[model samples]
Target: MDLGCNRSGKPKLTATIRRADSIKKGCPFMLKGRFDRVGNFWKLQVVNETHNHEPFVFKEGHAYLRRMFDEEVDMVARLHMGGLKTQRIVSLLCKWFPGACVIDKDIYNLIEKLKKEIIVGDTPMQVHVFEFDLL
Candidate 1:
């Protein structure tokens, strides 16, 4: 509902609100949201995951998402361990697993789900924003 703008031309994002529509009611996937503050100091909560189960790690004839000769999970773990930025992670992935198409969004989504934390870093810089240290 017109979430307004954040000084810049970019529209400020808000929590996903489903309008009263038959399509939303008929949809099987459940919606969830989380709030995160970016380096630009703007806060927004977006709908992250819908389905209860994980998407297919592999499809009928080929790798579905990452399609890497090496598994993505391992690479993700390595990136986390190395504390690399999204671009660095992608570069490392390219070096190790060439021909793999690893999107930063996908990497963020995977990191969010598996690590239960937000990938907080700037575009040209890197930093460990936060970690969900649950005791």
Candidate 2:
């Protein structure tokens, strides 16, 4: 289990109820919970009660995985490629989305993932590549 921060700057916590030792077992049982400031307590909710797919052993870079739309990712990628720092990008995003709040690390992770995708040929960059890539 790992404790983290959510997009809204609230505490985001997750726990693995059951671990899958084999691919035949499918996905591991996991639960995502959050802290409610108003109630001053933690709420444990089962986001995925069952696993239909195999779980990765090495979960590195998985922290950046969230429920974001493709358009949002594209917009963040564009901003990241535009030479905006992670902090500035986060501020802009928060402003554009009043109810939305983002942390620096998440933005950094998103930008890093975008850069890796571009390098690995998984995704194409819309911005021009200068001598020093603004990553």
Candidate 3:
């Protein structure tokens, strides 16, 4: 796992080290909290990792997933020439995906990713937007 520094200045590795027992009991695959030292006392932050709490790789994974979904959404949007109802579009995708799961959060993430890319208006946006629109 990537044990990089977090926004609160506590590195992920330190959290893992401190809360290894709790995580082992709960979900070893999760990095859900942090360890803080205030003078001579140490405190364990048992907060679950929210979307914003996620580290670099988590964000990258979401970005990659968002790109994939955006491509699909863009294709559908162009096919119908407008925005689509949430359920109708999801139903269409589900037909092809079968057991695959696409939730509201996934759609929101994709939209956010697309908007950010559009706002950036960089070379990546040019390539990805064209590809998405075409497909």
Candidate 4:
């Protein structure tokens, strides 16, 4: 998973690491929390504090594991075209998919790829020229 940033610009920390079957490292630490009405604040209770496997101390990935669904790409294009910044796009994506994390570089890369598809490549240029000729 890619590193995530919070409102204070600090890297968000998590114990849960999703890994493939070949490199599975399991950590059995869980924190279940709820709001306490009496204190009017949140309270956290640790369900299990045993470490079966190593937890990730530093997050490192090129977002290769994140599979961008077709609808997500479409949303990226639409939001980018609507003048939303990449950070906002990432935030929106996280909000839209609660269990998912999005990295801005991926959005940037996707935008560049989409631009290439629509801009002056041989096929794209030929189609644009053909349309112009028709006009």
Candidate 5:
């Protein structure tokens, strides 16, 4: 789960539960909660508690379960390719997608995946010779 401030300056928390290998293809379990400032406490809520398929063991390195959309990923890759730092990219994303729950690590992972997909080279010297292309 990641915690961040929403557009209205209120704290928001979100979490996503990926489907198991046995489950059918569909949207992952998702939950979004917000803090009630007047109530002076956190208000947790389940956005999608019921799974469309069966449950199984959780897998590792499921970056696709992230809340970011495909277009957002492309934008992040573009920004990173354009020389923006991870921190700066995060700030920009936060501003651009207020309801989105993104973290520095997510952007870092996206950049890594983008690099892996775009810039491929057999030798070390050949690295960085490929042009930027959004996947």
Candidate 6:
């Protein structure tokens, strides 16, 4: 979760970055125990009577929530280099990275990351190539 803020709270943006996360911090998860009668669910207990932090409001920006594992990233690179479209890649990623909240935007971000690793700095050249290919 390089949220544009370094540990010292400074920006180190190398490229144009757009962030849409509204994640917060200092939230604790707690709940009260309610009886479940469907399947004799007596194995649950509540240790705290009150939840101190807001879960819903601060649960968005955790890096683990949307992070791609090393293996997952490798698969993404393989799938992309094999000429698979982004949409298809995303669909397959869901199957491969089950329980992961991966979206098309994440796929595109990963693709761009892979591109950055290969091509040093040719963003403008990419745009020019796109235009040339369209002709």
Q: List the residue pairs that clash in candidate 3.
A: none
- Candidate 5 residue 22 Cα shift, in angstroms, is 20
Winner by TM-score between candidate 2 and candidate 1: 2
Q: Model 3, range 7-120, lDDT digits (tens) per residue?
A: 433234544535632111222222433345455554444344433343355443332333444457674445333566656656666676554456555655655665566557
**TM-score ranking of the models:** 6, 4, 5, 2, 1, 3
Clashes of each: 0, 0, 0, 0, 0, 0
Clashing pairs in 1: none
The CA lDDT of each predicted structure is 0.51, 0.60, 0.49, 0.66, 0.62, 0.62
Tell me the lDDT of model 2 at 48.
Answer: 53
Q: What does the lDDT come to for candidate 1?
A: 0.51
Worst 10 residues of 1 by lDDT: 19-28
For candidate 6, lDDT tens digit of each residue in 21-56?
343332233344555689866444544334434444
Q: For model 2, what is the alpha-carbon lDDT of residue 103?
A: 71
Error of 2 at 20 (Å): 21
Off by over 4 Å in 1: 1-70, 117-135
**Model 4 lDDT-worst window of ten:** 1-10
Model 5 Cα lDDT, one tens digit per residue, 17-128: 8633322244445667777889888777676555544543442233444468977888897897788888999889878877566778888887778767655644654553
**Top lDDT hit:** 4
Q: Give TM-scores for every candidate, taking all chains together and pairing residue i with residue i.
A: 0.37, 0.43, 0.34, 0.46, 0.45, 0.49
lDDT of 4 by residue, 68-103 (tens): 888889999899877789999999988897655568
